[model samples]
Target: MRGVTELLRPVWRTLPWPSLGAGSAAGLLLAGMARLYPENFDPWLALNTLRTAALAFALGLAFLLDDPARHTTATVPVPRFVRQSLRLALVAPIAALWWTATVLLIPAELRPPVGATTLEAGAACALALAGSAAWIRRSQEPEPGVSVAAGLLTVAVLAALLLPDDWELLVAVGDPGWDAAHGRWGVLLGAAVGGWLISTREPART
Candidate 1:
């Protein structure tokens, strides 16, 4: 027990707790704001707003692996996967809870399709983390959050612009493309996880 705690201490210490806290607060604030006009609510509008919040929080979570002591930690006895998993394990619960709370904060009638919206969130968060991992694997920077977040946002914007109308990824519930959009989301989620796992492999020791 003590051994596990000791191993996780640095992971916890290195976590970007402030960013996580701020992101959660911002997300919930956006979620709560959805209640401001329930009578005037549109499901598509609510989804877009809530999605903004989720993306913001995911961007914050992307910073989980931004160890300021990356070089020093790499020299520690702990395996990279152990340390990375510890970082992820530490943040996972909070992320789940925050998502749940965000969903609840919006009035039920105004909420988007829960399953589909959650799928989009899952894909987005996975992409953010995977992008961070890829950046860490390729670059020597101790912190990759800024670049990761920027790139994530850029791709999101570009996709919104470039994707065909028939294949819209952010389709309204019950729209013809809704189910298809989620299928794409599933593919994205799988790809992101695969990339993260492959990139996160402990780099060949020097």
Candidate 2:
């Protein structure tokens, strides 16, 4: 136990606690402001704001590996997966707590279905981290969140504008597409996990 604790201390110390805190604060503020406007708030409106906040906060999560030492660390005797596993270990609980708090922040009467909405949040979070992982693998940029954020926003805008009605990912509650949209969310989450795993692999030898 002591051996494991010693191994993780360096990784934990380097984790971006500030960005995570900012993301949680931003999500909470959005949820709280929506609660203040209960008169105009509906389930659909609540879902929209909550989903947007989750995605916005995930932008911060994308910075998890944004270290000036990533390239140097990559060459260390420790395995890449070991280092990243430690990073995830440290953040997973905080992320779960943040999600729970985000859900609770919604007014009870207007809250979206927790299970379905959580699937969306999970997918969004995975996509953000996967994007950053891909960036680090390909570009080796110590800090890649800036481009990841821009790319994420671009993809979101295009998804909203270009996707046809039948295949839309974000649909209003009670719409026929709601269940189908979440079905796609499941697929998205799977793809993102796969991407992250692949991206985190050590680079090939020339």
Candidate 3:
């Protein structure tokens, strides 16, 4: 308990607030577009707007692990896993609230299936965190956020443009392929979380 409390202040200080704030603002703005013409609400536009908002926030999450003091803190008594977990712990609730707000910004009648859309958002966030963790594991860079964000953007674009029809992940709510698409989202969420856990482990000491 004491140990955790001691680590809290430093961990809080290290968070990437700028990126997170920008991402959240961008997402909210996009989601708010759904309310622009309350009488003309379109379900399809609401769904895509939410999707874009999720991606925007996920791009910000790509910076979650960034710490300019990484090298300095490497020798701390607390394990890297604990520190990283703490960071996630601190941010998770805020992210959840942000998502909820984003969803509620649209008219209920125009909103997509909450469960499916939430799954997609969760998967996107997991992928971003996984990429950040992987980059940290493989490099000595103290701040890898920019590179990770760029990589995430590139992957998103490629996935949208190049993925074949049978493996579609961004299908419409009522499409016959919707169920299968979310199944794929489940698989992706699992894989991304597994990768993040593996990458978060402390590197073996020589």
Candidate 4:
């Protein structure tokens, strides 16, 4: 009701619409690629997208939750942790809807294995929650050089994603398609670390 609406107001105001739009576009492009290049319709692609979105959502939520400016008014009293947890909870159903819609749009043959889909979604949610919690805990007393490190890490992650795919490297190591799988997880972990560093460095003041 009113309480729920009020709690979400700040999150809505600070929502990263640009990033979200970019992600949605990227997802559509990937899906279209699968359709156009049926021969290259690998399940790994879907897994990568799922994991990346999961991680990104988690990082975004952490940033939004930890922003002190969101709680400028003292009139409303609400625990930060409670608000963050509720936001995380809301992402699940939305994710499910996204998954359903994505499936309906893609060719039947391009659909990912159900188990893999479930695993990736679960990993995304778990990593995001863990990242947000870590960020909140660290925000209590942050160190001086952490922000720089976080910025560097973020750049590194982008670089990794932009690198050309190496099938030979993937197979030589018996990784098969794990590069996409593990890479997404690595990005999530890096994002979590960055969020933790940022959250720890800034003191919460209302």
Clashes of each: 0, 0, 0, 4
Query: Global CA lDDT of candidate 3, please?
Result: 0.91
lDDT of each: 0.86, 0.83, 0.91, 0.49
Q: Across residues 57-108, which tens digit of lDDT does each residue of candidate 1 receive?
A: 9878778789888998787776666677788898999999999999998888
Q: What TM-score does each of the candidates earn?
A: 0.94, 0.93, 0.97, 0.54
Question: Which residue ranges in model 1 land beyond 4 Å of their true spot?
Answer: 1-4
What is the lDDT, from 0 to 100, of the residue 133 in candidate 4?
Answer: 54
Badly placed stretches (over 4 Å) of model 4 are 1-5, 42-68, 71-75, 140-206
Least accurate stretch of 10 residues (summed lDDT) in model 3? Answer: 33-42
lDDT of 2 at 156: 81
lDDT per residue, candidate 3, 80-183, as tens digits?
77888899999999999999999999888999999999999999999999888889999998788899889989988999899999999989989999999999
Displacement of the residue 1 alpha carbon in candidate 4, Å = 8.2
lDDT of 3 at 134: 88
The clash number for model 4 is 4
Q: Which of the two candidates, 1 or 3, achieves a greater TM-score against the reference? A: 3
Q: How much lDDT does candidate 4 score?
A: 0.49
Give me the candidate number with maximum TM-score: 3
- lDDT of each residue in 1-206, candidate 2, tens digit only: 46456668777878877877787788889988777888888888899988888877887787787777787777667666667767877888988998898888899988888998889889888888889889988885898877887788788889989999877999887888899999998999999999999988877879
Query: Can you tell me which runs of candidate 3 are displaced by over 4 Å?
Result: 39-41
Residue 2 CA displacement from its true place in model 2, Å: 8.0
- What lDDT is obtained when candidate 1 is compared to the true structure? 0.86
